[model samples]
Target: MVKYFSNDVDIRTTWDLVVSAFWQRYPNPFSGHVLTEDVVFREVTADQRLLSRRLLTKTNRMPRWAEFLFPANLSRSVYIVEDSIVNLVTKSLTTYTWNLNHTTLMSVKERCVFQESEGRPSLTRLRREAWISSGVYGFSRPIQEFGLARFKSNQVKAMKGLEFALSNLQGLRLTVAERRHGVSPASKTQ
Candidate 1:
């Protein structure tokens, strides 16, 4: 069985900021489960589009009831591959990600698109979609359902991480501007 999920949200930030935040979103408090990320490839196209591929390692703890089904040597970490395209002309970023391990039990593929909001120029629209499937015959239905639920929970944390990164980026810019003006950070409080 296969299950699908989709969601759309508008973030009160410009598309450029959103794109910048995405590149720095890791190591945030909300994403402790994400262990590491490495850029495997990146290139700028003739059309001024940026393409990138990254590999990520994340913790994947199984539920207590499901623990007995897997082999003892199975690693607690899962590998994920993400591919992204950034179109400077259109002010859009699109990414596709999928897990590289544990496919026999469950597989999840996700795609996200970030674009400038049509109604509000200062806002960015994020559209996310996911597909989950399992090959286990009798357990496919339950496994797919569990995958969908977990995906939803992880997405909440992902958004929080993004927000944290955006705030940090803005704060850094503010500090740089203040320093250039010869204004101390302490002076702002006074």
Candidate 2:
């Protein structure tokens, strides 16, 4: 069985800042399961859009009830491939990500778009979609249900991580601005 999920959220920030935070989202407190990220390919297209592919390694922690179903050889880590495009002209970013292993057990794919909110210029909107499926014989339904639940939980963390990164980026920029003006940190009013 396959399950689909979709959600939309407005981030109280500009699109440019959201995009910047996206690239620096790792190492945040909420995303400790994300082990490593490597850029496999990156280029600026003729139309000035940034295109990139990345490989990410993430810990795959199975629910205790489902652990017995998986084979012993199955690794505890999952490999995911992410492809993204940043279109400067449109002021938007889009990304697609999917796992490359253990498809027969379960598969999850996600796509997200980040753009400025139509009604609120200061806010950025994120539209996210996900598909979850399982090929396990009699356990497909249960496995798919589990996948969907886990996906939702992880997405919440993902957003928090992005917000954490954005907060840090803003702080760093402010510090730089203060330094450029020869203002001492201690002199600034909190």
Candidate 3:
């Protein structure tokens, strides 16, 4: 299955700590992009029922204030972030497993397809086909190197944002390469 490393930390408590630290103000400036409101806040279980009411009163299609306040359950942790460049919506979820050590793992799965009102098919058909054909492999060497380099460059600033939440938690060790299993039949002949 999916391979992930364990970190010695309490997943839930760490998550709460991190959220509280970063969500006080909107991370990115709302310049050029259309924002309905000036500020947003973190949502907890207590704010679930008020979501529809808030939505009804807001002028923006989806207000950032209400968006962040939505309750995250086991299935869906976060909703799609507002992006002005693309017309599609994107969302992400993260899960933690408590075992020998508390392991915090995150997977980002995104779709950029919009549904048709008349019940037409989605635009992800091409992406799905390419994925099935194994066209998209693991991250490229350049991509990996760039990611690590960026992380290193911003380590101090990044940690400042996450330290409170992750103070007791250790980062999960990540594999540099993606593991592949079962060779293609065509390669067997070679």
Candidate 4:
């Protein structure tokens, strides 16, 4: 069994700042399960596009229903691999992430796109798509259903985490254009 999830939101910020925030979002209060993040690869293309690969560690996030399937001694930390590309010319950023660990029980694949809002320049349109499945388990189909249900619940909390990061960005008194430059107005003075 396979399940899907989606989200649409308007972030009152430019793509640059949104992309920057994406790289810095894991440490927020709403995402306490996220333990560490590391950039495994990054490069700027000749056309000024940015490509990056990152690995993230999430701790103590296994769902209660699925804990018994996995061994008690199995490390609580799960690793996720993310790859993203920023199209500078089009003012958009797209990303894909999937579990690098715990592949046997379940796998969740997610995609996110940030684009300059056509109707509102000050806002960026964010879209998310996710697919989940459970394979190789004794009760694979039922496990997938259980995993999907939990994933949908987690998605809300995760979006709130991103929103929290945006609120943090907004708290620093950054102007619309200031966000594009990757700095708040007050930070420029020092």
Candidate 5:
């Protein structure tokens, strides 16, 4: 089992190794790269419109072209334009094709433990101090029994790797498929 942690907080533990492996295989796209003015300043509305039309006309098993037509609400025009450039670059540089794997990782959460210590009381204040220490000790036993220590340790490890990847991959971008306006007859309606 692998663990992930961020900012001293545990995120996930089990199956984290799988996630890390996937990340290593498919590194983030936007990593320490800058977009030139030519790339960012170029006109895209016309191209987007053209692409949208092509997307509507091209009907195939994979409806990826439709991404240009009805982009996700969160999609940015700049990223889309950049993606178009990347696509062109890939086509031109046949020897250096881009390999991006768009996959999601699953995470699970479980309860964990925390501990704190209190100072021992003087003999003169034995009654009050005894109850305090006893209560604290009682809670610690349950926390340890729950295997929270193990969970926390794993969580920390997983998150550290995730954060490292995210930070290093400077140009990481996520693309979501857009939905077409018309629904197919076979599709269920809301």
Candidate 6:
């Protein structure tokens, strides 16, 4: 079965600030599960779009009752690959991420779009679309269901993390014309 989730965040900042925060959202208070993130690749297209690829490692606990249902190798850690593109002309950012490991057990795909709100030009909008699925034994159906529930629970925390990161970044930009790529305050080791 395929389970889905959706949410949106509105921040009183330009889309640029929102986009900048996306690159530095990890290491925030609410995302302690994230262990590390590395930029695998980054480049600017001829049309001036920013494209980036990243790898992230995270850890999460399995419900105590379901511990025995998974293999011993099913530790808490999960690795994922993320790809993002920012279009200057459209003033929008699009991201796609999926699990690199644990595909046999399940697959999680997430898509996010950030843009300047049409109604509120001074506000940026973040939209998320994610789904989970598994093909393994009949066990995957239940596993996916459990994951969806956990995802829903964690969704709010994730948005708060983003807001915190964005706030830190927004404070750094003295002006909209000045490009600020400074590292997020929470981007460093806690």
TM-score of every candidate? 0.97, 0.96, 0.23, 0.82, 0.19, 0.85
Clashing pairs in 1: none
- Candidates in descending lDDT order: 1, 2, 6, 4, 3, 5
lDDT (Cα atoms) of all candidates against the true structure = 0.95, 0.94, 0.25, 0.81, 0.25, 0.83
Candidate 3 ranges with C-alpha deviation above 4 Å: 1-18, 25-139, 162-190
TM-score order of candidates, top first: 1, 2, 6, 4, 3, 5
Better of 3 and 6 by TM-score: 6
- Kindly list the per-residue Cα lDDT of model 6 for residues 44-149, writing each as its tens digit: 9999999999999988687776777777777678898999999989889999999887777778899989888997778988888889988778688788988788
Candidate 5 regions off by >4 Å? Answer: 1-146, 171-190
In candidate 3, how many Å is residue 33 off?
Answer: 16
* Quality of model 4 by C-alpha lDDT: 0.81
Q: How high is the lDDT of residue 64 in model 2?
A: 90
Q: Which lDDT tens digits does candidate 4 get at residues 145-166?
A: 7767767767777878877777
Model 4 segments beyond 4 Å from truth? 174-190
Residue 6 error for model 5, in Å? Answer: 13
Better model by lDDT: candidate 5 vs candidate 6:
6
TM-score of 2: 0.96
For model 5 the TM-score comes to 0.19
Superposition error at 116 for model 2 (Å): 1.2
True-structure lDDT of candidate 5? 0.25
Clashes of 4: 0
Q: Which pairs of residues have clashing backbones in candidate 2?
A: none
Better of 2 and 3 by TM-score: 2
Superposition TM-score, candidate 3 onto the true structure: 0.23
Instruction: State each model's C-alpha RMSD to the native.
Output: 1.0, 1.3, 23.7, 4.8, 26.8, 6.1
